[model samples]
Target: MLKKYILFFALIYILTGCGTDYMLSSFYLRKDFTWPTSPSEQKSLNYYKHVDGDLTKFNGYTSPSILATPANYLLVIYEIRDIPIYTKVYGVDGSSDMGVYVAISKNAETFSATPIRVGGIADDYGSPVSFVKGNRVVVLATGGIGFGNGKADEITKISVSISTNNGYNWTAWTNVIDTNIFKPLLAKANRFYTNPGNGTVLVNGTLVCMIDYKANGADTTPAGAAIIYSTDNGITWQLGSTLTYSGHRWARVIAERTDGKLLIAAVPNTTRNVDNIYNSNGALAWYMADSLNGNISSFQPSGLPNNSGGSIAGDRIQYSENGRSKSGILLLHSTPNRDYKNPGAGGATGKVKNAMSMSISSDEGQTWTLITNAIGQQEPYDKTSFRQSMKVLKDGSIVTCIEEGDKNVINDTSNQPFFIVYKRMGLSALSDGKYSYEGL
Candidate 1:
């Protein structure tokens, strides 16, 4: 009876602003600190792990979406999990009380230790994507769907919440992107599950973001992604034609090129122990299209280097130096470096998600070169880094939040315990002496 009462009160605490009194400090680098000259040296500096500062408050954190607002503040939205709360609220096997929380930072270095929770609908499968336009920041999270009765079902709907003054407070959760748009493709109800991409890009005056959907429940194949856009500041959303490939594709990352083209990067929808046929070459799939509509069925293999098993994030930046006379479109993507299919020597041990690398393209993602092999400081094969999101700041610095955990349970998707690791460096630092950032 005592234990039961203790659990009840603990649930109440979490549901009603649990981290209000928490003051978790992050390890921040000095503003004037001299950055390293080599790419290897830059990758090893300024990495900080963040949670509620205590495992008891939040057990795990994953699916981080990092955004750089025009006001120069860095905002991150990620999924927070507490086992007891999840088991009770969700009442499903391997359930965890899942919620989307936003952490704010003035500079990339220091952050708000106590994060503000973005109220969710179902509060499960909270993979959030956030973007900013001026002071109005919008976050779209994957919720209002249930995975119970020993199977996953429901036409996954995205919950939209907005904050007028940055991310201090958010409005009530509302559904966006009508379900009728997907009715033609679904054979029956709950046949498709949708997850928001890493970030959204504002093109001209419209807001565009990628939404990846896959066959849910008993179905195993026939998955695709779409481009959803809004002109009235996220009041209403319209979906583009379905972008399908040969095999299942999801976890897309979108960016706007200097030429005003939309670049969508996606990966195969497969997990550990599943046969990975789509990513046999260790690269992310790419689709270059217009912001509004285009034939996305012609997605080809992106030469961008990656581990090819997890989510990826990227953005586009323009480079122009007055004296040097260098100008071009710069595309950057960050993902795990391991190739699951070609895990040499020790097989699975050689393919752990320990190293998160950043790949850069000078000619609008036509060709990419591996720039930095490590973004966050993690021991190879000892710590696991998975599911990362990044945004290039107005000052030309790149910031990322990595989902990392103990490598012992790398195969375990749930209850493995994870932390959101933050890292940032100038584009020049990550690129060595090759390129320097003038602005975004």
Candidate 2:
């Protein structure tokens, strides 16, 4: 039995070497490597004040627009205070409610104190953002059940709230896109993509909203996740085609490049149970997809990089499945360690470390090359994880935020709910290397 088991393992390794390793090496290779300097040497800014409620916690803080401008500024929005966990069982009776608050930061680090409240909305969860375009500042939020009932079907709605006086005062909330319109046929069996998360961007003077929607049948199956665009500045929207893949996927961020192409990154939460048991034995993977002129190409290198040559551009173009001549889709996502059997468990047991992994595509979305895994230690829980928010600074330095400290649970007299127990991180120390920011 022992010999047979060894033989089986050897056979598996051989197959993986010929399959996974070959494909990965063809696309992904470590670039000029660097590491974060000492913690003290790292530059970062954190904003947290003890509000009236000891349970006041913020999650999903995002910028309204990826391309930052002085006149447009940056708008950060989040939910303040806590909700009862029991509300998940008893339903939203209005006894417990979460409020939405907004803060403007000119320098991305220092923020204004006066947080304006946007009324008529309930449970503004996930990454809610506000951006300025011409005369209007558009605020988009992910809608959750007003009460914490877990069963409530939350609709991903786009709310248009305009602010003329630099976000000082805002108009009433108006629903732009309803999730019901994009609901999949298998609604009950697959409901994860029911709500939207993260930030929104205005690409080429058109409003583009990216969201994660559920695909019915299996948990490991890929759902209907896509980017919806509105040419008339959020007045009307047209949904693009859904992505083609099988896994637990959610759209997180969108950015427009200098050449007027669209770049989108998504976090695919694939677990062992979902992968081995449900997803036909496929490993969990995070993906980045791109689209040129509303048509998605292959994945390419995201953000800026050193020595970005014709290879990066050409490979992404070649692998693009959408029949477009765009570059590759750059993928930056967190993956679990090998020792762990599942994603969530690995994350809990320090077996799932948050890593900043990258891939470059020259031919478009069809093929890709893996770049270096830059951030975090190899061991889980040993290195810090980059929060979903990432921005390219003026100095050409890549800036990403990490949640600092341990996880904590907040408790009221009657209920206890899990709240993110950490502070926001600013800039981190860059590893020793020659850095440049010519275009930025």
Candidate 3:
């Protein structure tokens, strides 16, 4: 029996170099394996003030985006509050100072000792999305003046920065899409703004990025997603179409299908309070866009749970399997499985959730099934895992980076610090051998 098992393992290793890893992972999953945490230095850090006027330090990371290249994996995160107090407590104007940083890894497991600062501002409203072709890498983020401070006439736009050398250094931030084009739309609303999204998908020689658009500063519900396109490999950009609705749409993400259709997923939030907008959105809204530009009618509720978490969808990847070529496009999603909104326990605002989950869909967003929980499903609520981004690598492996609350680093009962967690595994390993593919 021992020799038979050895021969079976050897045959798998001979068939695929990573096959043994997946088989072992599958066995471990049956045993309920514990996923490891990220390196200590990669966690985020910020300061908070106590009632007695003492300043204290905390650790946390948020809004992580990941990109895959031939030689390395790049992870971008909104890390470290450079300011003294929390944004929800004092406000967005003079209180919170968030910085954007990028960490590079030759292998997805180990990353740079210290991440390099990319872009950030006093009032950064959205996460960053990255695109890469050859040596040129582009990152787009939401930038504006005095956002969430309840001030009027505030301008918010999607800002872009380019790194010619693989995310090691980035240029000064500039608006990717000009707000002037939306002047007609802005005329109808008080403070028209755009926030960059989780990911972008390429279709028919164009890169389309789905962003959240707000008609006005005072409006409770968002104006739905605004599609932005780039025909020149993310060098230049323009606005395509703005999808509007009566309900609230938050944290919208997009991906392309094998048949050239685009799948958009957003957080369907019904909460009226501005403070709870980001805190709770129990379900995901799915929209099938027939084209890259328009034709999306309405987003229906998906089978995913009401996790109150920001959902991120990955771009599709075409791969071969069982010796066949160009088999299918694989799409992946990351979100917490349960609603994570509590008044004063989880994080600083107590608005986030834990138990980051990964779901897979091979049928172009038609159906989704949970593959695995990247973070432990039973972790404490304060051990938050939220706002993660994923990518399918050229090596048939999937890489992701998640923002998790550092349990040891506390800001207070209401809020906690966060850190970035980097994870990479073979798709077969992640699915417990349910899915496997050959790199194209």
Candidate 4:
């Protein structure tokens, strides 16, 4: 009987060691630091606009969309060489044929000028979505829809380009999945994710690419969009059996968790009565999906019950809240305002403003908690000044690309969009609770 008791005690000890918080002491050190309110209150924000580049030049264009990889590298995609050259006005000389360009920055502030053009034909690439898996840098470009004098009758194809040399160079353009599968109206959308090699148990080690496809025959709603997944490293794809919502307009990003689940941040077109007739609306919903063996079993219900009035414009997901995890998944989304038609607000159409927000899930995305709200001030007056991208800093404070225009600052007067008109904010201020260093 004594031997049996001893064996039971040993088993208890082993179970305690396997608890989730078992390595908490070693991975995170608890510390007390006053959370900053504004950008100036935090020392980490000093890196904002610190890079000495010509913001007024096409080389350093502003308002470019950004994405960060698990390797802590920042990928910024924008029109290269000339910004004004791409801005077309009614099919005249509106700079519409500008090619998609990419730049890399290891430090998130000071970027290196290793620009790589991602399209073959003239002005074939625009509005790119990028992510990194293993040693490969994958980029998805929306084929010529908005460029040149193109009508809505034109069908847009989804083109893909990859960079194995870490943004140094790219392979020739390959039409991975022809957009014509949907028929009549096909457009290229944003964002894709893949699981870390050999980490997840559910997905069958296949590189999945979730794409946004609109069925124009189905009410012209963005929520009517459907998701498609690729199994063979984007070589072949199979459309998922589900639709995001009734009129889902845009899909900004799709992130796969360590447990083989997928999280997609999408925009539904229900907020404004005006349908996304021309596909110019921002995001409005952050949808989460649970996949088993590369097939989606369940997803967030229609209308996104958790999504508040704030629309999830564009965002990404991280495993560890502080960057300590090699696996697992945590959702990071940006919420600008709803662009529903508000009369006398400025123009005849109601405008959507930008604000930063976040959400977290501990159980591989089964349920989520709204951990943070808008980090920056409200831009009720100006629409341009707002947060664009969210970046997790080395110190755990979430850094975002704060552009001038909405409520903070004015857009750079230079003919070229001012690149330096960006800033960062601490994540703690955005968090609902006090800043906890336990996870850092």
Q: Report clash pairs, candidate 1.
A: 86-96, 86-97
Question: How many pairs of residues collide in each model?
Answer: 2, 39, 15, 19
Q: Residue by residue across 339-428, what tens digits does model 4's lDDT show?
A: 433345554444334334456555555555666444433333223232144444444555444333322222223343334233354434
Question: Candidate 4: where is the Cα deviation over 4 Å?
Answer: 1-47, 50-73, 79-95, 113-116, 146-154, 179-210, 215-223, 230-238, 242-244, 252-259, 270-288, 292-353, 363-387, 391-440
lDDT of 3 by residue, 1-440 (tens): 99999999898877577666675876655433222222221122111111010124333355667776544544554444454343231112323565567777543445677777885333453356667766667777655532343556655556777788777777777776555765655565433333332456564556667666554343345566676777787767776666665454544545666677676666564454423433444556667777755587565634555654344555554533344444343434434434443345544333233356666555566665676644422223435444566676665555666655454222345555445666666555555555555453
Taking all chains together, the TM-score of candidate 1 against the true structure is 0.73
- TM-score (C-alpha, index-matched) for candidate 3: 0.70
lDDT of 1 by residue, 1-440 (tens): 99999999887677556453331222233331222224344433345556332344322566678876555567778876655331121211224456778888775666788898885444554667676766778777666443222345455556678888768888877877466765554543343334433556565667777665555553334356666777777767777656765544554545666777776776554532422421222456677776466655445544555554446777766553334633343333434435333234454444544356777666666666676665664443344555677776655566777765544224333444456777777666666555566545
Q: lDDT by residue for model 2 over 272-369, one digit each (tens)?
A: 33122111212332234345235564454333322100000110111222333333333333333313332445545433233333444443333444
Better of 3 and 4 by TM-score: 3
Candidate 2 global CA lDDT score:
0.38
Residue 201 lDDT, candidate 3, scale 0-100: 51
The local distance difference test score of each candidate is 0.58, 0.38, 0.53, 0.42
Winner of 1 and 4 under lDDT:
1
Error of 2 at 437 (Å): 0.5
